[model samples]
Target chain A: DQQVKQNSPSLSVQEGRISILNCDYTNSMFDYFLWYKKYPAEGPTFLISISSIKDKNEDGRFTVFLNKSAKHLSLHIVPSQPGDSAVYFCAASGGYGNKLVFGAGTILRVKS
Target chain B: EPEVTQTPSHQVTQMGQEVILRCVPISNHLYFYWYRQILGQKVEFLVSFYNNEISEKSEIFDDQFSVERPDGSNFTLKIRSTKLEDSAMYFCASTVQSEKLFFGSGTQLSVL
Candidate 1:
């Protein structure tokens, strides 16, 4: 079963606009959530993360908000740039060793 | 910044042939993992290793697949006899204490 899900397969937005990507999970045991961005033929890069202890985390233009009660999380990029065009994956980990469960990625296209 | 590196960015093998994918995780990272993404699908966890031993593995990691930390710098995944379904991008990731993972560009394995 897919514990993590990214229902939107693709998204398009104009440059300088805010881009929001959403994710949902079924496994309540997951306590740590992360977002990764990937370009074609490249390995995914860590973008942002939030622990179960906090409801939100932000770094520069990127922010992640988690709602444990709803089992949902989202990533928001302010004034999105063309460079931000890539596939975004949401992942979760729990307990020891940090085995991750990932969502089907959302492909973001920031049009200039 | 430290990053995970994988070798032979792409590999093409005939069905039932043995294939070995190699990775070198960032030094000082305590946890190592293997994940794969089939084309147009979600990234799936394969296994996690810590303290030179496997800490956890998914049901997808069967007898045909094996992982080894041959040395301090090398972590390898071996598929004794690859099948067509084994074709996918294999990513190696490392983490320190938290659940944040740094992933390699990945090795695209195509078993014909």
Candidate 2:
């Protein structure tokens, strides 16, 4: 079963606009959530993360908001740039181990 | 900046052949993991290794799959008698007791 899901397969936004990608999880035990950005033929790189206790975390232009009650989280990029065009994956881990459950990923295309 | 490194970026093997994918995690990281993504699918966890042992493994990590950290710096995944469905991009990741993971560029394995 897919514990983490990114409903949107792809998204398109104009450069300089805000781009939002959403994620949902079914397991409430997950305490840590992370986002990773991936380019074609490249490994995923860390973007940002939020703890179960925190509702939001921001790094540079990227922001992640988590809602525990809804079992949902989102990543928002302000002033999206062409370089922001990539697949974004949402991953979560529970209390026990280091195994991370990943979402299907959302492809973001920031058009210039 | 420390980064995970993987060797043999791409490997093409016969269906019944064996293939080994190698990875060198970041120097000081304590936890290591192997994940794979079939083309157009979400990244799926294969196994998590800590202290030279497997902590947890997914169902996909069946009898044919084995992981080893034979040396201080090298971690390898061996697939015995590969199948066509085993073709995917394998990523090795490491973290130092933190929620964020650093992933390698990945080794794309293709079984013909």
Candidate 3:
């Protein structure tokens, strides 16, 4: 079963606009959430992360907001640039061991 | 900045042949993990290793699959008697603490 899900397969937005990607999880035990961006033929690079204790986390142009009661999270990029056109994956993990459950990924296309 | 790296960007192997995929995680990271993604699918966790031993593994990690740190710098995954269903992109990741994972470019294995 897919514990983490990203229902949107693709999204398109104009440059300088806000781009939002959403994710949901069924497991309440997951205490950490992360977002990664991937380009074709390249590894996923760390974008931002949020702890269960906090409802939101922001880094540069990327912000992640988590809603524990709804088991939902989202990543928002402000002033989206063409370089932000890539697949974004949402991942969740519980305590220590370091195994992550990843979403199917959302392909974002920022048109210039 | 250090990043995880994998060798043999692409490999084509005959069914039933054994194959080995190698990875070198960040130098100072202490935890290691392996995940795989079939085309059009989400990334799935396979195993996690720490202190030279496997800490946890998913059901997908069967007898045919094995992981080893071999030496200080190299982490490898070996598949014995590979099957066509095993063909996928395998990623190696590492983390120093928390849930932030740095993933490698991945080795795309094709079993014919």
Q: Which candidate is the best by lDDT?
A: 2
lDDT of 3 by residue, A14-88 (tens): 999999999999999999999999887777888999999999999899999999999999999998999999999
Candidate 2 chain A worst ten-residue window by lDDT: A93-102
Instruction: Candidate 2: list runs displaced more than 4 Å.
Output: none
lDDT of 1 by residue, A1-112 (tens): 9899999999999999999999999999999999999998888899999998999999999999999999999999998999999999999989546798899999999999
Return the candidate ranking by DockQ, descending. Answer: 3, 1, 2
Task: Give the poorly placed runs of model 1, Cα more than 4 Å off.
Answer: none
- The TM-score of predicted model 3 comes to 0.97
DockQ for candidate 3: 0.78
Q: State the C-alpha lDDT per candidate.
A: 0.94, 0.94, 0.93
Looking at model 2, the pairs that clash are none
Task: Report the TM-score of candidate 2, chain B only.
Answer: 0.98
- B43-74, model 3: which lDDT tens digit per residue? 89999999999999999999999999998999
Worst 10 residues of 3 chain A by lDDT: A95-104
lDDT of 1: 0.94
Residue-level lDDT for A34 in candidate 2? 93
Rank by lDDT, highest first.
2, 1, 3
TM-score of only chain B in every candidate structure: 0.98, 0.98, 0.98
TM-score of each: 0.97, 0.98, 0.97
What number of backbone clashes does candidate 1 have, counting pairs of residues 3 or more apart or in separate chains? Answer: 0
